[model samples]
Target: MTVDPEYASALADGLTIPHYVWGKQVDPLGEIDNITYILLAKDQEEMRLRLLGSATQTMSIILVIVIFVSSTLSTAWRVFRQPRSVVNWCTFVQSSSATMAFGFGITMKLSTACNCRWAIWTASLGQAISGICASIVLVWKAYLAYDRDRRFVWAGIILNLPEPLYLYAAWMHSRTTFTPLGGCTMLYPSWLPWARFGMDGPFNVIFSAAFIVVAARQYRKHGSAVWGSLRNEGTIGLLILTFSNIFCLLLTATNFADEYSMMFWGVDWLITNQILIHQHRPMRRSLHESGRARGRNRNARRHDAETLFHPQPMSPSDKFAQWAELNLLQPKSNSPLASVLEAPEPDISDIGHTPAPNTASHLHSTQASTGYW
Candidate 1:
């Protein structure tokens, strides 16, 4: 029952050790309880490794495909329904590329026909396109937020040019072999397994950093109130892109398994797309409302100015009075006869002359006689 040390070591290292019986090469692991047959520790470990690798790959493939498909559909729907902006178009491109890449990846994982030479080529191409689109999206947003120059955008495109070439080269150079547990397992180059990350990582990080700086500057210059309204629309998408790229880079740097790393990347992209879609709606609504408010304010100011300069028309009675005054048809009465008929007014000359000495004596005698009794 003792296993050979060399066989144990090879098995531990995930190597398939050949079974031998009676000094002849034999499939002893296939036989049961035969005295001439023997199973070594390496065989058991190899089996376990294959099983684990297969399970991991299957799970990863499923997860990536589901996430990519759902995200792609959602993004496509948004792009179709909503007005297209630079950001929207970028999102659409990223989503579409991701969908194709992951879809092809799933086919490769599931189909035996994927062993053909063209499979890897197509897979590499799809992934490269997806990555370039994503990088462009991030850079585009940054440029729009800060630089907004066509030259800068073109420069970004130029910078991303090498990614696809590198991806194809890396994929072509990668080691692909058939395994019993997994149909075809591709072992990429140790130095550059993911060409997308290798080529676009620096650019993605730099542009993301630039976006953060530009967003911060905008927030400071415009104040929190103004920036707060724009946070979801402008800053959040950049933040998501930055963090997702950082996560992918960290996973790659730490030498995490490629299956898990790729799955994580897909999930991150799906979440980013969802966030962008969610943020887009509110941004559009806010913009629409602001435009309406501005229009209403303009109309109100115009109405106020018009009312201030031009008086309102008079009512019917007021118009009649105005017309009468203009035609000199109004009544005027200040004649003495009219005043005497209304109420007589005593004259100052009469008051001074009427009270003569005779009048005064006769008035006094009459008053005394009337009151005598």
Candidate 2:
């Protein structure tokens, strides 16, 4: 087999990706940037062992953080007011999967930099777990959007029901199908990796199309007749969210298809983060509004209670209050007709006679004295 020194050197020179080592599973002195170097498995198993130990440490740290975040979010949902029902659950799945992805990255996928057979096994486990969660969330999100809108045409209620089940089966396959392909991966049994890629595409198409279709229909049906801008904004946000997720999840299929030998999980990272924390902006806005609301609520009640109980004269030093009142309240006009019009017109029958239009001005003069204006 060809040595990887040129590749490692090229990469190191191009980007600053950190490196670690596992067992003899990876080429160490591969081309870091553009220059070739030694350090293949034949060079030194001792160095490989050291890299493995360090990688294991890194994986452990990431795994711990993932567990903490997942548990904390779960507990928060159970005890406190959940941010949302479906969206929150989807988020939990995404977060857990992400943690697992990171664990896998540090373990088997990046094994060249940090190789260990045990770490490889652990990484595989983490990746499988993440995949299973992703499958479930995908199915859930699709159904949630469709059912909420009550949109479908002859599609079965459990149309995408096979998603989670297929994912579980795929995870099982990964266990039985692993190989020593210089690292831990389900690329063994050859059929398994392709199978995974196969499942992801159909799964993504079903759910993504479902959501996109439903959202479009909803916008078309309601957007036209409804003059409410809030509806439009909400519908538009849903579209943005749906399309972004579709593009993100679609990568799983791409990975399976081997479009790129190198997997970039960053898109997946940002996608799940955006999805789960969909309400992040809304939550932030609510917090800001709540502060103002609390103050307003307190002021409103105080104003009411004070008027009913204290009935004190306005303080002259309260310039703000005075200025606010002046700005908020319209001032009365200093003209006679303006004052007269401000008063309620007397009932024509109360006079018991019809008045001449010429005397209308004289009748108005009496009303201003009562200060109804």
Candidate 3:
């Protein structure tokens, strides 16, 4: 852990880091001038931030990739089998955004004085593209939810029209520095954090509001039975996106450019993509038909229906496989496995037969029906 005198001197003279500090200790501050000691301390802090940022960003990237891969694989066959232009384009943009984020993160982590400018420009362009694409995807979902309402769609389009130019302007005013730790850091104007909030906050609000309105309409049409429909519709994923966006906004506003900041980058796109995949899963769409029927029978109290239907609820893994069957298997009509692989339709014959009192079986039945949202 011996410190190198020449390296230390060069660092104190404000030169770029020549090498990484691998378990090497800083020389005693007693032998250095006050200015050198201060510089060393500052560099130590910057190095800590750099290493932490790299680690967290790596984890974020890994998680995003896993989500993308699993979601894409699950939907790949279906996407091809039933080609919808909206979903197709959405998948493309999600892939593009994830790629840009991956590249931008790698460049930031591996940046040096030699590539500092490259990192800066990459960051500016890559991040702008990623963010704007994510926003567009979100707005498109809202537009579809609103039944392609012109006003809502046009508002979203116009609001986001300035995103590229705004980002370009912000990057122009931003300052970049090469850290003594051999990483690049960008210092943006205070308005940048709020700019991010402004860019994303409205879309999230609009999308969430539109989703809730749709849910409410379903509820009015189906009553308490709408739970199953909601579950099958990826309500949980929607809520996750809503809360995560709010949390990230809070962090960016209060602690801008801190360790927590970069970790959330591209998360919205990842989660949104997952939701889209989940919604389009074949099992979910089939479930939705029964979901409405279940809602329709909500008023006729069938307290023991759940107990009779699901004496023992399926386990999580079993439930997942059941849900995943459509993605994994397409039973050949002539094969023996066809009968085995095919799921039995739920017998809603007894759904409203008896006007029994409400009971916990209702809750159990609800959980058993959808498993989890």
Candidate 4:
């Protein structure tokens, strides 16, 4: 075996060199075969990792694309078929952000056409957008559930604001590099996991807790009716999201790879936006309708019960006039009979009058004496 002078010098100095590069050392005997095998094995492993990453990314992208198409079509259909309403614009933003994040990521991973910087930056921006928009939608839901109380809304906004800010700062310091097998690898600081955790963990806990509390209150107030209202709002979806967030937070807290933890990222975005887009409208409408129904019932109760019942038998004048018309007189204008019939009855309630017990008899006696009846 013949060793190159530089290789001998590097080995003597205890400097480490890549096996592939070190393989270039002159070896007239068959000693280079071992280095070649090592390099080949390393290449194989790299290729396998690249292939696995590509396959997973492709699957995530396909899932997100399907969800995006369906959600877009559904939202469009709703926009056209329904009247203008309190539709949350965040729903649209959520869908777009998820699609963009996954789409850009998959595109950058699969193809080498675009600059990596652009692709990675766009994907990062999309992720930030999705997270922020999702937070907004959650706070809005809590707002609606709590009777549109601005105090909680403001508190939620304040609490959630830090996640995106920290995310932005972390992303600024983050870096990525292309692997030997044509895959991108995220290079981040040790605190990257904490950043990811902060992006979703605590705020999700608060929002999900708020929702669950509201649901409990509704169940208490309305019993089974809460099911009817929450069916439209997808209470189960909220639980799913809460659990998913908790799972993601655990993954991050345990120092799992960001890439592995992100498998559900796009799917989470889809569900978040889908809940807001389809379920929220019905929930809001149900709340508004229920409110209006209560108002109507309250107003209905204020009406005088006597007015709702049939008027007291009939006034003596009305009975007598009817009998006279049937038996003798045809109603004629400018006649005394016509004047009697046309005269407006004084409203007892307005005049503060209480009729006597013999009021009907007394009225009949007076009319008979006056020859009016």
Indicate which candidate wins on lDDT: 4
Give stretches of model 2 more than 4 Å off.
1-41, 44-84, 104-125, 135-141, 147-187, 222-341, 344-373
The lDDT values for all models are 0.55, 0.44, 0.54, 0.57
Q: lDDT of candidate 3 vs native?
A: 0.54
Please rank every candidate by lDDT, starting with the best.
Answer: 4, 1, 3, 2
Model 3 regions more than 4 Å off: 1-79, 107-127, 135-139, 142-147, 178-182, 222-228, 231-238, 256-260, 266-373
Give TM-scores for every candidate, taking all chains together and pairing residue i with residue i: 0.53, 0.43, 0.53, 0.57
Task: Output the TM-score of candidate 3.
Answer: 0.53
Q: In terms of lDDT, which candidate is stronger, 1 or 3?
A: 1
Residue range with the least summed lDDT across 10 consecutive positions in model 1? 29-38
Give one digit per residue, the lDDT tens place, for model 3 in 1-373: 4445635643564554433223333222212222232234446776466455445555665666666656555555555754554555555555555555455545444442224334455556755665565556556655654555677667777878767864665456554443332234454566775677677667766665675566556566566454346644546666776677677666655655463443344555565566655554433343354243322243234646766776887899998898778645666666778776676977888877869866788878888899873
Residue 152 lDDT in candidate 4: 73
Estimate the Cα RMSD of every predicted model relative to the unseen true structure. 17.1, 13.1, 21.9, 15.0
Q: After superposition, how far is residue 164 of candidate 3 from its true place, in Å?
A: 1.7
Task: Using TM-score, give the best candidate's number.
Answer: 4
How many Å off is the CA of 117 in candidate 3? 4.3
Give me the runs in candidate 1 sitting further than 4 Å from their true place.
1-52, 109-113, 116-119, 179-183, 193-198, 224-226, 229-373
Report the lDDT tens digits of candidate 4 across residue range 1-373.
4444534433433333333212333212112211121233335676576566556655766777778867666666665654343354555666666666656655555554443445555666766776777677777767767776798778867876666665554356554433333234444466665666566767766775686676666656666474456653565766776666666556644546555543444455566666666556556555653442322343345454555774568799999988998656767777788889889987777465665659788899999999997
Q: lDDT tens digits, residues 153-200, model 1?
A: 877888887876766554555533334344234445555634545566
lDDT for residue 168 in candidate 1, whole number 0-100: 54
Among all windows of ten consecutive residues in candidate 4, which has the lowest summed lDDT? 26-35
lDDT of 2 by residue, 182-272 (tens): 1232332344434544544455456545554544564465553222232344345445544554554455445543422113234433443
